[model samples]
Target: MRAALGLYLELHAHPELSGAETGTAERFAGHLEGDGATVTRGIGGHGVVGVLRNGPGPTLLVRAELDALPITERTGLAYASTVPGTMHACGHDLHLASAAGAFALLAAEPDTWNGTLLVVGQPAEETLEGADAMLADGLYERFGTPDTVLAQHTAPLPAGTLAHGRGPMMAASAALDVVIHGRGGHAGTPQLTVDPVVTAAATVMRLQTVVSRETAPSDQVVLTVGSLRAGSRGNVVPDEAELSITVRAATDQALERAVEAATRIVRAECAASGCPEDPDVTLVSRSPALLPDPAATAAVRAAHEREFGRHRVLDWPGSMATEDFPRFAVGGVRTAYWMVGTTSPRQWRAAHSAARPVPPNHSAEFAPDVRTALPAGIAAMATAVRQLFKETW
Candidate 1:
């Protein structure tokens, strides 16, 4: 517990952005090497991989992210982020520390299980590009293919609770950047030019109907415009307005329908406003929905019940939150990812009693109660991995 807490504090103090996690990678590599594992760095843009072989047994892969968000820290903790405009708001620091602790435990008790463990510290998970980059750079080829892949994330549930399900654990996601072009003109003149500001407003309103009217009520879909940029000054109209949107769905077909509907609405709105050209809709950072193998999930869930008891281990529904962890299952390897609660019991009770909202993951005020979460995370992860090995044995 002491070792994991110390590592978590150090990581939280010095948060790094995605694809720029040089120092974070070094720290993870150091921990892995210290545990007598063969370490490799720079796999796919600051990614680190550690391999430990105990005998002729099935290989299991465990992954942890090594990047932070661009938000500033507002938790006011003693070990808050020192880097400006960057924070571990998503609890990747907790993930790293827990994985490191699990690795250390396995190294210390070599006879507990006999299997090759591959620990991956991946970069750029926030942008949803890191997992593919590492795989393209030959992650499996260098480390050998694994029988199962395991990962977990932090959630707002009460600390010491574990959650998982059979299918669609996380949503498939796409990032869309749309540029609406118009002729610049004076704001005072009403009839002088095509007003893209008005067009962008209409586009936003119309997008809300795509999910409500166009798609079936049974299907789950979410389209959010996170960023918008228009004219620089209020007096003069700008030539173009830009919008950043994110789309998510439980299935690929539904995701495609949502994207198509969004593009059509953007183009039709721009055309109706008499713009010079159609709005440009560019899609990037595409990720498939995460569907864990049912058999693998069952085995891991049973392991958790044994380790933490049935009361602490809860059945979870699929979440709309998306991640790049599913990319590692591209080659048909069985994968299972779970979520562990980070909020303390006191905070959870206060939120309900005081009517105060709990700080969710990716919020600036999201400071995980590491005192309780870290130990549970380590135990749950290590127990799951050991269960996989025991089944193979």
Candidate 2:
């Protein structure tokens, strides 16, 4: 546990932004090679894949994301990030530690299973590009296309519980960037200027209607305007206004409908506001929903029950958060993604404060309670991987 915590803290102190995990990859690769696993580095722009094949019968792929948010660090911990404008607020440090711990455990007892294990350190999950890069770089073709894939994410749930869902564990997400252009003018001339700020505000309000009125009531959809920037000065009417939106849906059809509705709403709102030109809506990032296979989920649950007792296993409702791990599932392999609790009561209360604003994932203050959560995550993932190899291989 001390060693795991040390690794987590070291990673926390040296957080890297998306697609810039060179040092992180090298550190994990050294550990993997030390444990007798065949390590491959620089596969997908800093992704490291470790293969442990012992007369394989079936292959199992385990993955952990290795990217940090772009927020500045403010946790004030002794091992807080040293980088000026980067932090591992999403607990990726813990994720990597648990992954390495699991690998170490398996390496110490390789005779327990008769198969191949692929441990992947994926980069750029926040930007939703790492999984695509891995696949394009022959992750499946080269690693023998896993029969089952298992991955776990640290969550803010109760400290000892392991949360898993059978189907559609997370929602599909798409980032929308809308740019509205208008004619700029001085504060004194109100009649001649087209106020893009007002137009952008109206567009933001109209975007809410896409989820409420355009989509069906039963369809789970979320349309959020996370950012809006218009003018440089208080009195001047800016020439352009920018709006960033995040859209979530449960299914592909629903996601497509939401995207179409958002495009229509932005165009209509821009026309109604009498903007000189139509707004440009672009998708910055996108990820599909995670649909877990029932058999694979049951196997993982059984492993949790055996290793940590039945009371520790939990059934959770589907989350609206999105993960790129589901892309591996799309390749015809069974996938079960679990949530490992990482928040304590004290941290939860502090995180919810409105004044100081402890932002969740992208916030600088979003540090997981690593001292208590890292070991449980490691044990759960290790037990799941061992059981998967036993059953499949």
Candidate 3:
């Protein structure tokens, strides 16, 4: 736990963005090597896979993220992010640290459990690309296929708590990059120019209907225009406007419908504005909803209940947050994903008392109660792995 805390602090301070986790990977691989695991680097863009074979048994893979978000830190911690515009707001640092700590525990007591341990530090999880990249690069072919893959994510709930979902664990997501082209003319000549910025603005408004009007009220769907880039100055109208839209839903069908409706809205808005060219709508990335295997999840949930008690462990009412971790479930590998709470007791009470929202994952103020959360997370992961080991594959 102490070692994990140190690594957590170091990782939290020097976070790297998605696809640029070179130094982060080096540090993580180094730590894994220190724990006497055969660490392999450069699997799929800074992805680290450390193989620890402990006799012959069912192979278990524990995965954690290596990259952080692009948000700047505002958590006001002593070990706050040193890199500007990069922060571990998503508790990935905690996840990585817990994986490292759990692997270390397993290594120290090798006699307690059988089989191999595959610890993966995946990169580009923030952009939902790392898992696919690793799989495409032969994650399973290179490393032997595992009987089970286990992972946990941090949530805004009070620290020392674990949440498990019986069915759907997370939402499916699709991100699209759109470009609207318009005829550029003098800004003063409103008659000659077809302004793309106007089209983009209109498209943004119409996109809201994809959820409010089109999607079922019972369904959870979120459509966000995260980025909109247009002209540089007010004087000159740019030839094209760009938009980055991310659509997330509880089901794949809803996600597809929302994305289709969004793209249609963009094209209609561009056409309505009499734009000179057809709009370009490109799929940036997409991830299916995370549905953990029932048997696998049951084993891990029981392990966590034994480790953290029934009160601290609760049923997760599924969330809309999406993850690429599901990609690792390819090739008949059963997977289980759960949530570990991160908010401190004081933070929880204060937020509840004040009736204000606590800073969530991806927020600049998103800081986990690492001292409490990290240890619990490490125990949860280790216990889950150990319990899975005793089960028949």
Global lDDT scores for all candidate models:
0.92, 0.85, 0.92
All candidates' TM-scores?
Answer: 0.98, 0.93, 0.98
Residue 79: error of model 3 in Å?
1.0
lDDT of 3 at 74: 90
Model 1, residue pairs in steric clash: none
> How does candidate 1 fare on TM-score?
0.98
Per-residue lDDT over 118-213 for candidate 3, one digit per residue giving the tens place of the 0 to 100 score: 999999998999999998889889999999999999999889899999878999999999999998878899688899988899999999999999
Q: Between which residue pairs do clashes occur in model 2?
A: none
The sequence of per-residue lDDT tens digits that candidate 1 reaches over residues 1-393 is 677788899999999999999999999899889888899999999999999999888999999999999998999899999999999999899999999999999989989889899999999999999999999999999999888999999999889899987679889999999999988899899588888889999999999988999889999999999988998898998889999999999998899999999999999999999999888889878999999988889999999999999999987788889999999886678898899999988778878898988899999999788988999999999999999999766
Model 2 error, position 345 (Å): 5.8
- After superposition, the stretches of candidate 2 with alpha carbons farther than 4 Å from their true spots are 345-363
